[model samples]
Target: MKLVTYLLLGVKKIGVIHNSGNVIDITDIVNTDDMNVLIEQYAAVEHLLKKICVDSDARGLPLADVHLMAPIPAIRRNIFCVGKNYYAHAQEFGNSGFDSSAAAGNVPAYPIIFSKPSTSVCGPGATVDSTLDPCNTIDYEAELAVVLGKKGRVSDSDDPMTYVFGYTLVNDLTSRQLQKRHSQWLLGKGIDGFCPMGPVLVTADEFGVPANQKIRCTVNGEPRQEAAISDLIFDIPTLIKTIGQNITLLPGDIIATGTPAGVGLGFTPPRYLAIGDKVTVSMAEIGELTNTII
Candidate 1:
């Protein structure tokens, strides 16, 4: 099932996107308005969601009437991001001369994890603030983000997949100059309004296995990136095991799997984003997350 947080008539609400192409207002179905709360109570919440009152003949609110926000607008902590998880993207960054991770041959032996503060997240249709970077070398990376359901450290015998809550798409917008200068990703990639996520968060059961799903990115109608989720150098289970080995992952935690090739930097001259440029990150099950550079 696809769940969403939206603003309708100045009030924030939680909605279920029905197959009818309308959003069912389910905000009152539960005691809390927080998306994280629902995730924290996922098993119970899923049970209740199975019995929603809306039926086929009854249409709910038209999608155009409500403004969608990030599934969890105010995330509790920093979002974990993996860099160069795709061999092709690793090759591109290796060739671009901006790979600060500076692994032996562009690809690191282990996962390169970084974090983006909650303040950086913005909802779909929001304008990305380009002026934040003085060098103006904004680039877009389309990523399939994982939402964690349970809080625990993944052990050897544990199956990481069971802990997954669902999935969502996020645009990992970056400032090339800041990344190259700082040597680490935080400042360059975590700027406010850089992460444009949402429209809907598909539950794991509804999303099925992460494999076979393709992440495609386009800039102003031109196709820039395309790759299957299975193409990642490190898959979901490995990522979870890598991070959860030490730090205890909590419910509502977000992990961006990483981007594929065809980023602007992959170009010869570099096709950095300009003010007013449109970027749309799309996947098969999840809908497109489109944003404009301002």
Candidate 2:
């Protein structure tokens, strides 16, 4: 079932988005409004959630009346992000001349990983404060973010897929100049409000095997990026293995799979984000996550 974290009547609540486009308030029922706790205990609660979804007498709050938050609004730690996971985006970055992490070529031999501070996360439709970028070279990268449910260090005997909770979208905003100057990612990509994530988190069972899902991003309604999940140079399982080898993956951890090509910097003359630009990242199975620069 599709799940969400939202605000209704000035209270943060956990909800299930019913097929009718209304929200089934599960906040009180879940015993904890923290999405991390809910996910960590999902296996124990799945049956109840399913029963609620089909209950004819259950009341659903109108979707239009509530404010949507990122499916997991308060991520427990810095988000694990993949860089240049898509072949086309890899080549574009290598050619853009803003890349500093390339060893020999555009493509990575393994996943290029980085992290965005949890403070960087904002919900859908929230305004992205672009002033944080002194460089004024703000750019947008649309990516599919993986949300982990289980806690463990993935090893040869563990199946990484079992650790997945669900999926969401993240627009990995960047400061081109800072990235080029630092020659590393954190300073450039970890700006406050840089990560705008989620319209909702579609559970793994409901989202199904996502290898073929399409991800598209538009800037002020104009198409900029589009690619299938299959286009990634490094797939999800490989990413989980790479990161979970020693570090214990925990509930509420987000791994933003790298974006596909067609970012603003991909152009001969870059079309960086400007004030009032509306950037939208979408996956058909999930929903659109649109945010405007302030």
Candidate 3:
């Protein structure tokens, strides 16, 4: 089932997307506030969702009637991001000769990971502020994001395939200059309104073959990045397993798997984003996520 967190008439509620292309209110069946207590609640929440199918047929709400919020608008923790996981992205960054030593032939054997401060998170249709400092050179990266359903300690032996909740699109906005100046990725990636996520979240079952899913991004109407999730140098399981090797994984935690080749910074002349540029990040099976630079 396609679950959704949405706002209807100014009130936020949880619901299930129906077959007839409608949204059925299931908020009354499951307590939204209780979701934060544990990951297992997702199973219970799903159980109650079964009843909505009946009620929806009789009194279901149409998709056109409500405003959609991020499947989880206000997740309690920072969003984890993986970098240089796609070989193409690594190749481009390396070939650009911006990092000459890196360009020649240096690639990390492990996943480069970081966190986006929770404050940077924003919902669908939200406007992102472009803090266009004179020294700032901002860029965009489109990536497939995984949402965790089960919390596990880094030492846990279970695989990540069992811990996933769903999938969503992520735009990892960057300030290239800040990144280079600080030698830390957070300075470039964690800007407010930099991470635009979700039209909605698709349950894990709905996104079969998570690793092989196709992903792409376009500026305005021109395609920039295009590749498959399978292109990831560090696949989801390895990423989760590796991160879990030290850091704890929590439910509602979001992990951005990294982008493909063709980012603005990878260009010969460097095509940074300007004010009023519209970007659309899309994946097959999953829907398109669009946002504009301000």
Clashing pairs in 2: none
Error of 2 at 34 (Å): 0.6
Give lDDT per model, in order.
0.90, 0.91, 0.77
lDDT of 2 by residue, 1-294 (tens): 889999987899999987677899998888988999999889899999988877878779887789999888888999999998888888888888888996525599888999999889999999988889998999999999999999999999989999899999999999989989999899999999899999999999899888979999999999999999998888999999999998999988899999999999999899999999999999999989999999
**What TM-score against the true fold does each predicted structure earn?**
0.97, 0.98, 0.91
Worst-scoring 10-residue span by lDDT in model 1: 50-59
Q: Per-residue alpha-carbon lDDT of model 3 for 1-294, expressed as tens digits? A: 677777888988877777666887766666652233324586766655655654544566786688776666677888889877788788777666444322234455877878898777776777778864345577889989988888776556676688788888889988877776666778678887788887667888878888678998999999999997877898998887887777778888889998999999898789999889998899876677888878
Q: Better model by TM-score, 2 or 3?
A: 2
Query: Which of candidates 1 and 3 reaches a greater lDDT?
Result: 1
- lDDT sort, best first: 2, 1, 3
Stretches of candidate 2 exceeding 4 Å from the true structure = none
Q: Model 3: runs farther than 4 Å from truth?
A: 33-40, 50-59, 97-105, 132-136, 154-157
Model 1 global lDDT (CA atoms, 0 to 1): 0.90
List CA RMSD, all candidates: 1.2, 1.0, 2.5
Which of 1 and 2 is ahead in lDDT? 2
Q: Return the TM-score for candidate 2, rounded to 2 decimals.
A: 0.98
